[model samples]
Target chain A: DAGVTQSPTHLIKTRGQQVTLRCSPKSGHDTVSWYQQALGQGPQFIFQYYEEEERQRGNFPDRFSGHQFPNYSSELNVNALLLGDSALYLCASSLVYDTQYFGPGTRLTVL
Target chain B: DQQVKQNSPSLSVQEGRISILNCDYTNSMFDYFLWYKKYPAEGPTFLISISSIKDKNEDGRFTVFLNKSAKHLSLHIVPSQPGDSAVYFCAVFVQGAQKLVFGQGTRLTINP
Candidate 1:
């Protein structure tokens, strides 16, 4: 059984540009959630996707969005990236709000 | 505002001893609590969890204790080893919500 997996171990983007990070949830999982971990900080919930629709969101702004496909894979998109956007983006998968399994995460560097 | 808080930023304990890390929460509505361990440049791995209805949950070398009256919880590791050193995060799950609120994490170091 493969665990949650994320693409592009690391990424670099310039200000005002857009970037998309991908995630494949663990096998037998259906829900996907995204989180952001800044330097010296804990991971903060960005949003959660279930049934191909965003179910709940955190304090993030509209610029942060996500999508879930039928296969339970997910993608996080950040538009008009700012310097503060630089952080480790983590993806977690679960079965209907149960215990979550996290991925290695994609490190986004906004220059 | 941070619902969960780990007051101690770091702790050092001698190997083979017990290491106790504490966490406090301000939200009474949080029904589930969890502890996650993270290594450098890696996502956090779930350690243990306790539901509001239970006061304690144990798994192998890890034990999580909850005091709902005080809104406090703790993770205790017995016979701490050097490999146990890592940043530990305490998280809470609100009822009817899929989101988890995390603390600023506590870095644990076990000296040999």
Candidate 2:
């Protein structure tokens, strides 16, 4: 009955550091998608995971990557972070693809 | 290039009035469209959606109208309430693609 859940509601990291954010999909959901929302902007798609494999990716750079576990939980990893990397990272879960239920998101601030 | 666009950054409407948020897309391949509402410090929540085959879909006070020919869609909230104030985003799903393209969101303010 629980919706999508994300860990480390807020985080602060320095430039060039790596950070991993976690997400647990809603019950009965098999697909997980990651998105980034900068201040005053809409959420941008990063990638999507299904069947424990990445199925689709957005225009993001190689620094942004993600993984989906067998339990349908997901992790978004960002390496060599820059100041522009500071934003709200949102995780969404769905049965298929388009219809998504989102989590509260993890706010990452890169200094 | 931004495929999805919500040109109006903000909109203000009086309580009990109607609020119409508009969105446009440049891609004709988009088959499914959705609207999401978000509050500060929180992720977006699904509001309403429409597929390419349909021109309109409604849920209570919220209605989404799609004009495929124009590659445009609009969300209308009738008798808007103060609680309706939030940032609304328009999203498009490309056929056969699992990813969604999002617009720059419109901040709606319902004044009482």
Candidate 3:
């Protein structure tokens, strides 16, 4: 089975612009979470979605928002992107109370 | 303050030897700990993990040890191979929070 899939392998956006990244979770998995990894750093939790609702969020601001569809696919939206918003956007999927499997990640560059 | 920390930024080990990566966490609420290996341009891959209740968990040549009293965890790879070289991240999972808090990763280099 396809583990977890994310779209737009790489993206370049200017400051103040908005960007959206997509993810399709692994089969039979219901939860999707987003993470941001800066250069030379580990992945930082952004938020998690369960049952089409956001269940948990990290310290990230509201500029970072997400949506999980009924089919279990997910989307991450960043409004008014700042240069600091540049990072690798990773999407992970898991079953309830199961280990998460990650996608290849979308490399976002906010210039 | 960072909840989890990997003191070593990188480590070099000879093939056929043991490679140990260490991590420490400040949050006592975390019940599960995980390790993830990553290569350039790819997402982290889940490795072995241990729960707070257990001190050790083993899988193949990789073993993870957790010391709850010390709030420390470590990953040991026996007979390390060149292919085992990658950036390893220590992550703590809270029981009900369902999000991973990751430490700054340690890059492991196994030289042949």
Candidate 4:
């Protein structure tokens, strides 16, 4: 079976710009969670999507948002991006309340 | 503040030796402890996990130990191999939150 997948392997955007990253959950999974991993640090929780609704969110600002579709695919959108927003964006999928399996991250560079 | 911490930034071990990675958490309310292995340019891969109610969980060469009273956990890899050279992160799952709080990763290097 295919594992979780993410799109636009690499992206470059300037400050104040907006970027959208996409992800598809692994087969047989329904929940999707997003994370941001800066260089030299572990992934930080962004938000989680279940049933097409955001179920939980971390400490990130409102500039960061996401959506989950019926097929279990998801998208992460960042508005007014700053240089600090440069990081690896990861998408993890799981059956509700089960172990999360991550997708190869999308590397975003905000200059 | 970082709720989870992996004090050691990196470690080196002989190929045949055991590698131990440690992690500490500030909260005792976490429901589950998990270990994830990540390679360069990739997302973390789940290694193993232990419930708060249990002290230990093992899967093949990987094992995780939890000490709730001390709010500490550890991952042990026996007979470390070259392919095991990667960054490892320890994460906590809090009930009702549905999000994982992760520690700064520890990079492991297995030498031949």
Candidate 5:
């Protein structure tokens, strides 16, 4: 069975630019969550999607948004990116209220 | 305020020795706690976890101890191997919020 998978292993963008990251959840999983891991820090929850709607979100600003397709794949979009936004974006998938398994993550570099 | 905290930024131990990693949280409402290990260029891999109702949970050579009164938990690895070296993160799952809050993470180095 395939585990959680993320697209575009790495990305480079400039301040004020926008970037999109994609993720295909693990097989048999329905919920998808996104996280950001800055240098020397742990992953911080961004938001979670279930039933094609965002069910929960973290303290992130409105510039960060996401979408979940019917197939359980999800996408994270960051607009007007800041240098501080440069970090590793991780995607995790799980069944309802179950243990989450994470993807390899996409390294976002804001120039 | 940081909900989950791993006070130790780094730890080093000789191979085949006991390695203990600690974590503390500020909230008492957190019912579930988990530990994850991450290597360079890879996402965190779930290690072990313990629920608030249980003080201890064990999986093979890995064990987790939770002290609810102290709002603290710990992960113990026996006979550490070099491959075990990585960054470990302590995370808490808020049932109401349905999200994972993570600590800053602790780097574990097992020297051979």
Candidate 6:
């Protein structure tokens, strides 16, 4: 019954630095999706991973990418971050076509 | 352009009164709609969802109404509680797509 869990509740990085965020989905869920929520904004989908492959993506740039492990855990990697990249990174999990359950989110502050 | 929009940035309601949050989408292709409640520093929690084929769906104190013709959706919370005060987001998806298009979110405050 454990819901989606994400690591590193908050982090600070300088511009041009690379950062990695991790997520472990809720038990019994398969699909994993990543989202970015700017201050006072709703989450914008980054991409979705199913069967270890990225099945869908959003309007984000190539600098943002992710990986899903065999255990259904996910990692979001951002390369050469910019100041605009500062936001709360959320991880959501769901069964195929089911409602997504979101984690607490990692607050990334790019200076 | 924002496909989904929640025009109201904030709303206040008295406890035990009805609270209505509105959302509108410009896409006619959206077939499913959902409402999510989120507290500060936490991710959104699913509140209610309605399919395009249905006009209304109710669960406990929450009811979601959809007007496909107008491309609008609404979430009603009856007998609102203080615990229900949070930012509410309206999300939409197409029939076959897994990605959701979300509104800007409305902050609801239920006063005691």
**B1-112: candidate 4 lDDT, tens digit per residue:** 9899999999999998999999999977787988999999888999999998899998999989998889899999998999999999999887688988899999999999
> Which consecutive 10 residues in model 6 chain B have the weakest lDDT in total?
B93-102
Candidate 2's error at B21, in angstroms?
Answer: 0.4
- Write candidate 3's Cα lDDT for A1-111 as tens digits: 888999999999999999999999999999999999999888999999999999999999999999999999999999999999999999999997889989999999998
Q: What is the lDDT of residue A87 in candidate 3?
A: 97
Candidate 4, A1-111: lDDT as tens digits: 999999999999999999999999999899999999999998999999999999999999999999999998999999999999999999999999989999999999988
TM-scores, all models, native as reference = 0.98, 0.97, 0.98, 0.98, 0.99, 0.98
* Residue pairs in clash, model 6: none
Task: Give the per-prediction TM-score of chain B.
Answer: 0.97, 0.97, 0.97, 0.97, 0.98, 0.96
* Ranked candidates (DockQ, high to low): 4, 5, 3, 1, 2, 6
**Model 1 Cα lDDT, one tens digit per residue, B9-85:** 99999999999999999978788999999999788999999999999999999999999999999999998999999
Residue-level lDDT of model 2, residues B1-112, one tens digit each, is: 9899999999999999999999999988888999999988788999999999999999999999999999999999998999999999999977566877789999999999
Candidate 3 chain A TM is 0.99
Better of 2 and 6 by DockQ: 2
**Tens digit of per-residue lDDT, candidate 1, span A57-102:** 9889999999999999999999999999999999999998799889
Per-residue lDDT tens digits for candidate 5, residues A1-111, read: 989999899999999999999999999999999999999988999999999999999999999999999999999999999999999999999997999999999999999
Worst lDDT 10-window in candidate 2 chain A: A92-101
Candidate 6's DockQ is: 0.77
Model 5: CA > 4 A from native? none
- Once superposed on the true structure, which residue ranges of model 4 sit more than 4 Å away at CA? none
* Residue pairs with backbone overlap in model 4: none
- Proportion of native contacts present in model 1: 0.73
Chain A TM-scores, candidates in order: 0.99, 0.98, 0.99, 0.99, 0.99, 0.99
Deviation (Å) of A70 in candidate 4: 1.2
